[model samples]
Target: MCDSVAIIGAGNIGRAIAEGLVAAGSYAPAEVHVTRRRVDRLADLAERGFRVSADNPGVVAACDTVLVAVQPQALDAVLTGIAPRVEAGRHLLVSVVSGASIAAIRRHVGPDVPIVRAMPNTAVALRESMTCLAAEAAHAGALDRVAELFRAVGATLVIDEEHMVPATALCACGVAFFPRAVRAACQGGIEIGFHPEEALRMAAQTALGAAALVRDRGRHPEREIDSVTTPRGCTIAGLNEMEHRGLFLRFHQGDHDLRREGGVAVRR
Candidate 1:
C-alpha cells in the first residue's frame, strides 16, 4: 500500500475519503496531503495534522498516489498544473471526478502515467460507500491497488470503462434514491401512527436490514422481498400498491435520466 496520498480539491467527497482512510487506520492524518484553492477551507484538516496546502504541484510531488476529486469544470486546470510533476513509475492517479475518462486525463498528464477512475457516493462519509472503479487492461495492477484502497471505506466493483457512467447512476446516484425511498417509508410510518423520530428510526433500520438480507445472504432482492410478502398479507398489499403506482418504472426512469445526465456532464 502507498504510505501517502495527495487528495486534490478536498471538497465533500475528498474530505470523506481522507477521513475514512485515517479512521480505518489505513493512513495516518499526516500521511494524507490535502489541497484546495482556498487553503483556509481546509483549516480543520490542517489542525488535525494533515499536510494542507493550496499548492497543487507541490502536493502531487510529495505523494505517490494522486486522488483527483475536483469538479469537472476545475479538472482541466488542476491536471494541467500538476502535469509537470507527475512521474509515470512513481505515481498513480486515481480520479473520483464524474465523467472524465482515463483517455481525457491521459491527454493532460501524458500517456505513461496510469489513471484509474472511481465513483463513490454520498454514503462515503459513513464508510458505507459502494465505489465503482475502472482502468485499462494495461493498468490492472493500479486498478487492484485502488480497489484495495476503496475497500477500507466500503465495497468496490471494477467494471469496464465503458460502463462507468451507468455505474455512477446505479451506485453513486443510487445512494440518494435509496434515501428518498426511506423518506417515503418514514412518511408511511407517520401515517400509521408512529411519531416522526420513531418513524425515521424504524424506516431507516428496515431499509438497512432489507439491504443486508440481500447482501449477506447473496440472494436476489426479489427473492428476499418474496420471503416477507405472504399472498394476502399487508406486505404484499403495500408492494402491489407501489407497483400499481409505477414504482419500478419510476425507479428505472430515474436511473436512466441520471446516466444520461452523467454522460452529458462529461461531454461538457
Candidate 2:
C-alpha cells in the first residue's frame, strides 16, 4: 500500500484517481489528501473521509506520494508552492498534467526530486482507465511504484518519455474518440427505429463486447471482423460503406492532429 498520497489540484481527474484508489481497496480514504484552490470544491471528498485542503504545500509535506493533476497552465504555480516543502528522496512526484514535460517540472521543483508523468483518461472514475507512464532512468524504481498505484485503477504502460505525448493523444484523447463512435452507432440505431435510450444501450454493449473480444481473446480485431463479415452480408455492406466514407481515416487524422497540437487534445 502507499504510505500516504497527496493529490494536488483535486479537480475531475484528481478526484477520479482518489475515488478509484479507495474503491479498489488500495488505500483508505483517510490515507489520501486532496487539495483544491477552493476547499469547498472538495466537500464530497471530505465527506468521504479524505483530507481536503487548499494548502498544497501542507498536503505535500504530509504525503510520500504526490499526484500532480493540475491543469498545465496552473502547474508552475503549484510546483512553486510545493517546492520548498518537497523533501528529496522522500516524496515521489507523479504528474498527470498534459503537455508539461519532466524537465520543465524538475526546473520548478528542483532536480533531485524524482518525477514521473502519467496520462490517464476520465475512465479512471470507473477504475477502467488506460494509463501510460514515463520517467527518467534514474527514477525507474519510482516509476514502477507509480505504475503499481495506477494499475489499481486500470491498465498501465511504461514507455519512453518522448512517447508520453503520443500516448496522451492515443489513450487520453482516444477515450473521447471511442465514445463519439458509440454515439454515431446509437444514432444509426435510432434511424433504424430504435428508441434513443435503447439504441444507446445496444450500441454501448456492442462496443463493450467488441473491446472484450480483442482484450480477452488476444486476437487481431480483423479476425473478429472476418468472423462477422460473411460473403455478401449486411455487415460487410455497412463496413464497406463506412470504409468508403473514410470513417477510420478520420480517426487517424484526428490522432495526427492531436499529436501536432502538442497533445493538448482534451482539457481536463
Best candidate, lDDT? 2
- lDDT per residue for candidate 2 within 133-184, as digits (tens), equals 9999999999999899989999999998899889988898788899999999
The parts of candidate 2 lying over 4 Å away from their true place are 266-268
Q: Which lDDT tens digits does candidate 1 get at residues 1-268?
A: 5479999989988999998888877899999999998999999999999899999999998999999999989999999899999999899999998889999999998888889999997677678889999998999999999999999889999899989989888887787678989999999999999999999999999999989999999989999988888878999998889999998888898877777776442212
C-alpha TM-scores of all predictions: 0.95, 0.96
Relative to the true structure, candidate 2 reaches a TM of: 0.96
The per-prediction CA RMSD against the true structure, in angstroms, equals 2.2, 1.7
Model 1, residue pairs in steric clash? none
